[model samples]
Target: MSLPLDSPALALRAAIHGALAADAPLAALLGGAKVFDVPPKEADFPFVALGEAVVADWSTATERGTEHALTLHAFSRSGGRAEAMAIAAAVQEALHDMPLALAAHRLANLRATTAEVVRDPDGRTFHALVRFRAVTEPL
Candidate 1:
């Protein structure tokens, strides 16, 4: 078997990007607003893209061949803390459960470093940090 050229981290990123894209109200609410802009309705809550993910090296922690780390920045524009957390939780669920781009990509572990509300100049922003691990079989 041949190893896939793309890394598991890239696959995870693609999944996340796809999930956000499919969330229409989220796209519109956040797309038109800035980092901490509040949305009128709960459904239109924004999912702001802070920046590109910083992937860490693979590690050996369990049965999985390797572990990976991805540092991503994002926020939701919601008024209530519960609403923001719900959105963040949904994001976390997607990252953990989404299928890998390649068959070789397998998720082994996942964690969320930050998933809370933050005070910014613009307003209250829902901030979150998602960390996940994946095992990619070598070709």
Candidate 2:
């Protein structure tokens, strides 16, 4: 069995679980505070921002070599570009520690030259692209 690239939230959870199987430390990427009648806020406060990460999709097992791809996005209400990049770098470093087996033919290859922070007037989201390959030898 193999994982799919447009995987659901559950699948994303599984991918995160697998990536973080080593117990690495990371901060939250989203969800904190509400922009209700409380007050007006700037879009650059560190604490005002939230961090999130998920594996958008990856390849599955097939007769042909499996090509895995993952997209990680971080969001912030304040739209802090620097903060988002920092968080993205942390996530990328964590992913590097994935216990994927090179011998077992399980490896992740990065596609994007760099992780970028995407910001809209509404919010900010960091983007990173990674590709993986999974192979099994013949019995």
Q: Highest lDDT, which number?
A: 1
lDDT of 2 by residue, 35-128 (tens): 1111245433322111233333343465323333444544444445666566556556665545443432433332333566666545444332
Per-candidate clashes, comma-separated: 2, 11
Q: Which stretches of candidate 1 lie over 4 Å from their true place?
A: 1-5, 19-45, 48-54, 59-66, 103-114
**Cα displacement (Å) at residue 37, model 1:** 19
User: RMSD in angstroms, all models?
Assistant: 7.3, 9.2
Residue runs of model 2 more than 4 Å from their true location after superposition: 1-13, 18-24, 28-64, 101-113, 123-139
> What lDDT does model 1 reach?
0.51
Worst 10 residues of 2 by lDDT: 30-39
Candidate 1 residues 1-139, lDDT tens each?
Answer: 5535566655555555665556655444456433322223443445544344555555555433444455444555566455555555655665564554543466554555555555456676666554444444322
Candidate 2, residue 96: the lDDT equals 54
